[model samples]
Target: MRLVHPLSVVRDAQDWTYQDVVDIVAKATKRSADRRKAWKWENWGVEPDAESQAALAAALGVPLGEVHRLGWPGWLPDGGPVRTSFPWTMAGTLDALDDTLEHAMPDRRGFMKLGGQTLTLLAGQWLSQTPDALAAAFAGGPVDEQLVEDLESGLPRLRRLEAALGGHRARLLLDTELATVTDLLKQASYTEKVGRRLLRLNAELARLAGFASFDAELHAAAQRYWTTGLRVAHAADDRALGANILKSLSLQCYDHGLATAALALATAAVEGAGDVTPRTRAMLLLRQARAQAACGNRVGCDRSLSEAETQIARSTTTDDDPAWTEYFDPAEFHAQTATCYADLHRPRLAEVHFTTALDLMSPAKVRDLATYTIQSARTHTALGNADHAVHLLERAAQLAASAPSHRNTTRVLTARAELPMTKKDPKVQRLDELLATLSA
Candidate 1:
């Protein structure tokens, strides 16, 4: 006899609905109306005996173990002792199939179309559990795994919702949601509760999809998310969370080269995170320093960096810190500081920081490698070491090739431009040739 896994049997039976399964069993048995009713046990009735159990299994073409698994009345032949052989229930089997379907269909657009009703129902389920999920996911533990899984599960539904609404309609819906959330914030009693927190998360999701618009109207959406998230954090009386949200906004500004705005946001975060933990304060200050350096404010940047170091030193324990701020460490700070110095044309200072930063970096942060290598080349060029600069730039170019980023490509191109002016350099010529190949 062929043995099938209980799970596989359940999956194969999924195409037959509950009612369909009952109908199939009824027809196969060819019982009279009263006998069919007795065998199916639609209402509460006595359990089936061993002979009846065998008959039902033969009709259903499923293992008797499968029927006995549910532990329902009439599940066993003659309502005998509970069957230990059955490993899973029909419901459990169906649920496994449901989970399998959800996992197999990760792409948002496809699933929404294929399972619209199921997607909607699951979305509601996720929303109902949002508060608990958020707390656990952000709390640092096995919760992150579940949180990611939930997000993955909900993504298809969200995509479907977006597709149904289209661009303009979706923006309108987001705007309306944001307005409702803002109004909720006005009521002091609800400010610190689950309602406000959910709204904050909703705003963040809207911002993530905003860039998909044609005109790229994501800036307003991003600001809405940050602002709402800050208010929610404040309501929760979580200073670190508020600071982290502000830090995200500052990084966005920095990405756009809005140095002044980035600096302002980072400084505000440092100040507003009042009496916040020393580690959090250091992180905010580090961001401030990075922004200042980007703006060519050498003195201001150095001052912020020093302050950050001092704060880090003052911390006795960093174990209970926020998840977002955990990425800041001595090496990361030094690397960022090196980039600042390089931008300011202080090659010696840049070299010191870059070396320290490089030493601290892990192999996983491969993208950072290109940035650090490029900085090293620029520093060498500034120091009048053309040979070393050429060698470093070549390495930087090779790294850049492996990972294509427009911003890093621009940096490499600029570095190549500087090579021609170096005095009587074969290395410079060779570097130029390599860069030429890249352009082609």
Candidate 2:
């Protein structure tokens, strides 16, 4: 997910197509427009002159230095300093994460990768329940069952917060709660059975944090947290949880347009989900459909989607599903099907599914409504319904005014960018103005 150039930040921030930036740069620099298309695709790199760099900096509303780093071209500061210094204990892990958030929170380029030390720490947590260590650690206070129960009870509410307020608002809160839970795990000693449960809960917390980070577009941070969650899940021997995390990673890759990587990951998710509940299986299949669509595998996409729907129809509540599996429902199936159709450019089918999903969505799920509206609008725009698309876009804007998820914001912007209208179009102009004020 590393960006090739700093200008990619502008591309992401403004939701501008690469061609748009190339044209702007060409016009501003009085350069040949003939080279713009090739440059846009980066078939070959074009070294920007001083004037062109200045124009790009001004156009992107960033400092010139930020627009193009000299000598070495990377988001990282020169010489790559060590990002972690804490020990391998639970308290040390939390401290490392706090330090990570401080340095990486403001800029995606600054997000730290999971270093070897952190992996060693998680491996130690996995080994801590060995017979010799368990007997020796009888000195600490016994693990409190009540604290674990309290943490478990609050998860659904935290999930609801993520749904309503978006991941930008929930990431920090989830991290705070994770820190508290880790503090408990550090202080409270328990038997192997209790210890395993605690680790499972910690894994869930880390997975949620990763999910929030992914939604907020802190991509590298998301990867780090997701990998940490995977390690924790393996430590806990929670195959279902691990599969779910891999599915999330697949979705992230699909969103980034890495269809090949996404397909492999989604396939791995399905393969790794041994003896999974039906609902979880269906969700994984839906993710597989998305990845297939991204890869231009029409037949494979349709087959996977059919299997997903059939599995959804057969799913039942008594399937012994994980708590996270509760969120997937008939409406979600329809919404995801709409996404698959949208990707395949089957606009008519996409419109039908998106409309039905929207109708089924509860008003309480404001973020879902907003996201679906954007999806439906994209279908409409593809089908040559500019006015209808604009109408839906306005509704989406209203819904997003209160809850601005970075993921949804990017979707809306990309959809807006795809409209077959000139800059002079009033609706297009309005969208441009509206986007200028939306939170990034």
Candidate 3:
């Protein structure tokens, strides 16, 4: 059996230094370690205490027993073999889809540590046109306009639910709907034209499902669903939807700190967008700007943002735009800009855009408002305005109370973790109390 080093496992799973791991372990175990000892243990090997093992599992975003299983001889007796790879099949995809839908996501550490081979496999899966065995399992039945209308009508409601509540519930609902659609497509019959339309609808649902999963912080599931959606889009020859999905994948990569992958994906989205409307084009360009910002290409980022603005200015109607793109307005544009600046560590500039974004915060986009509030709080903290940061966090907390988003909660906790406040501070204590309730 190959021996796996604990530090190496930590490095593969998350972006944290040795000291960071030591600090987390110390806090979890209620044991203090000097820097020298921490470095020595990290460089060597040591049996972890119970709390340290639990903390390592939490930090690596896996089950506690999984951590015990990582060591040779399997320290956690009776535990099953640990999965060294993500499942790569239709059944695996559906199972993961169901998991995301029915359960809260696993701890979502970012994706900078994701292996290059994983990215390659995902990209290949997305671009491949191979027939799925599941599609062939059931006989086809008759397709109709009524069926299409029923599916289409449900879309708006899912979008609303995701916006009003959070991604976790919405993702589950979509997964159930998608399972039904998959069954319909497998068992139901249709003409070539109708089949194409149904495939397009399937692609849309898959893409939305992926977005909901992402919002819920089910990162790996989101990537898989997005790839599946892209495959469906290609079956329908829906280049526009394909581009949209590609752009979304790029955003996911950017969120995970894979800037190079993000830039490549964004570029692919823009190049393949074909005859998409100006609004759609603008949205894609904004995504490119985000990727560029992540790559620290300030000039390129500025150019992309400028191009997006020009495209938005020229867009008159959404008639040519896809239904999924109705939310890309001035406020969203400003919010994206603020995020780019925030990523670049330009808090002053981020502050300017965030303020404008707050002014334009649409009442319908509760989750977006909460996200922006947290981003604004981050900016305030960066600018040494702890008081203002606390105020913004309070507002965010209030919004989160009504919305109940896992993503928002994680962001709030992460931002709070960065603050200089000790547990003795009232605000810090309040945050801890709030987090307890949220996790409950």
RMSD, one per candidate, in order: 23.7, 8.1, 8.3
| Candidate 2 displacement at residue 145 in angstroms | 2.8
Q: What is the C-alpha lDDT profile of model 2 across 1-440, one tens digit per residue?
A: 23334445446556766667667778888776554653543324455566656666667565667746642123222223324344444444445555444443344532323333443333334333221222223345777677668778999998888877787688888877777766655666776666656767777877788778777777666765665565556555677787787777778777767787678777777876678877899999999999999998999999999888788777876788899887787778899999998889898999999999999888887888888999999899889998899888878877887776887787888878878889898877887777767743
Query: What's the lDDT of the predicted structure labeled candidate 1?
Result: 0.52
The CA lDDT of each predicted structure is: 0.52, 0.70, 0.71
Q: Give the TM-score of candidate 2.
A: 0.74
Query: Model 1, 1-440: lDDT tens per residue?
Result: 11012211232345433355345445656543244444245323445445544665676465777666755332322201111121132222223323322221121110001112322232222222212212212211222233334533453454445434333334444444434433333332321234335433433433323322211223333343444344444434555566666666676667656777677677666766767767788888888888898789889988988888888888766356654444566777788778777767788999998888878876544446676788778788788876777888888777766544434566778776776465356777777777776555
Per-model TM values vs. the true structure: 0.49, 0.74, 0.73
Clashing pairs in 3: 141-187, 141-188, 141-189, 142-189
Misplaced by over 4 Å in model 2 are: 1-107, 110-139, 422-433
lDDT of 3 by residue, 1-440 (tens): 11123353344446656677778878777788455544555445555666766776676566766666665213332212212133444444444444433332332322222333455445554445343333333356677777787887888887788778677777777777777776666667766666667777877888888788777766655665676676667666777898889888888787766888888788778877678888899999989899999999999998998998898888996357788897887889899989988988899999999999989978778788888999999999999998788888888887887887777887888888878777898877776777677666
Residue 432 lDDT in candidate 1: 74
Candidate number that wins on lDDT, 1 or 3: 3
lDDT of 3 at 167: 73
Candidate 2 pairs with clashing backbones: none
Give the best candidate by lDDT.
Answer: 3
